[model samples]
Target: MISDPDGTVLALFAAFCRIGGCIMVLPGFSSARISLQIRILLAVAVSMAMLPVLWDQIYPQVTGKGHSYLLLVTFETVIGVVFGLITRYYVLGLQFAGTVLTMMIGFNAPPTADVLEDTAENQLTNMISFAGLLILFLMDFHHVVFSALVDSYTSMPIGAKFDPQNVLITLTNTLSQTFFIMLRLASPYILYGLLFNIAVGFVNKLAPAIPIYFISTPYLIAGGMFLVYFGIAAMLKLFADGFGPILRGL
Candidate 1:
């Protein structure tokens, strides 16, 4: 059991380079609220658990590799980062959609701390972003990420030459897909705001003497809020449903 202690350690670290790299930028796990120590520990724990399953593949590639081991670490980390970014970018798409929704609905309240992160965001943006993330967690999205990570070892074996072009292509595709999905989610709000603003513009022209801008704002916001109340469930359901197919497609 103790014959190849050094090799075991090396293999474990190799595994960590990938898993830890993914967790380093993963959405919920990488939030500023999560302490650094906890992230490291979780990465190490997962790496250890994975090493046993991947020992035949990882242990062989790492053992006796000497100077080349350093290069392996770098490539492994990069691949993991690509995997993590895929999911991170998708979640960020939701945040972008939230911002658009807030602006469209005229809910331009003072920005406050984001519920999931330290950044300041409009209250409506914060609510939509947080709600979307919560729904993903409830749907066990992390499990999907982990499953993909496991499959990656087979598709992208350790010590394989890193392909930056392929990585770029994957990320570009993810962003493209994420943008379309988020656009669909926010489309209703977009239309509401567009139509509402046009009507308000005409009313302002008709009552040029009155402060129509001030008068119409409350109605604009109220109508937007009503739309959100009635539509949020369907919006999040579509968001959650889309996550699986997108990640699996990758």
Candidate 2:
């Protein structure tokens, strides 16, 4: 039923190069828990579904003679990877916040497997990262990511030359913006930790014989937990809200 099935297949492969590459690094999809074969199949399925919609744009490009299809594949994959990393960095920023929060709150639980990845990290950090990722899933951040990938064809198009300068600038901006967002979210706990430690130090100074540091451990954990109980909802809300603006800005 199809005319030029070969061209169609080539176009599909081209689409896959980008979509599959993006999925390989995108947060939820890229989790180590997701088998690589499953991700590959999902990418192929998505590429097929998108093929009809992108047919006109991709078909012409793929059908052209004398163009190195291999080169195109490499470039498209790079572009996809770059796009994926942009979203990935935002999520990684949450992990940074988690680490900072865990350290500040003194939740020095033994290291455990990360819920999202196979790597070991402090238990509290793992918990916070998982919770933040779960919230992002509930909000359908993946939908936004794929939508933006679709639009990227218009802005970046197929076969656009890779710009290291732009890539560097984008990454720098993302890091800076994400850092500020993380800082703001964790600022309350940071202040709480600082003041709590300072006060404990003062008490220890006043009563040199008393083991104030030992005495303060339970209170430190309790106060941090209380702050988290009150502030976690807002923290995640702010974090999820920032994702859109950051992606759009890039």
Q: Highest lDDT among the candidates is held by which one?
A: 1
lDDT of each: 0.91, 0.86
lDDT: worst 10-residue window of model 2: 159-168
**Tens-digit lDDT track of model 1 for 80-99:** 99989998998999999989
Return model 2's CA RMSD, one decimal. 1.4
lDDT of 2 by residue, 1-250 (tens): 9989898889999999999988999999999999989999999999998888888778888887446888989888987887788888888998999888878888888898888888999877777788888888898887877888888888878866767788778878888898999999889989999999999999999999999999899999999999988998898899988887788743
RMSD in angstroms, all models?
1.0, 1.4
Model 2 quality (TM-score): 0.95
Q: Can you give the TM-score per candidate against the true fold?
A: 0.97, 0.95
The window of 10 residues in a row where model 1 has the poorest summed lDDT is 241-250
- Candidate 1 Cα errors over 4 Å, as ranges: none
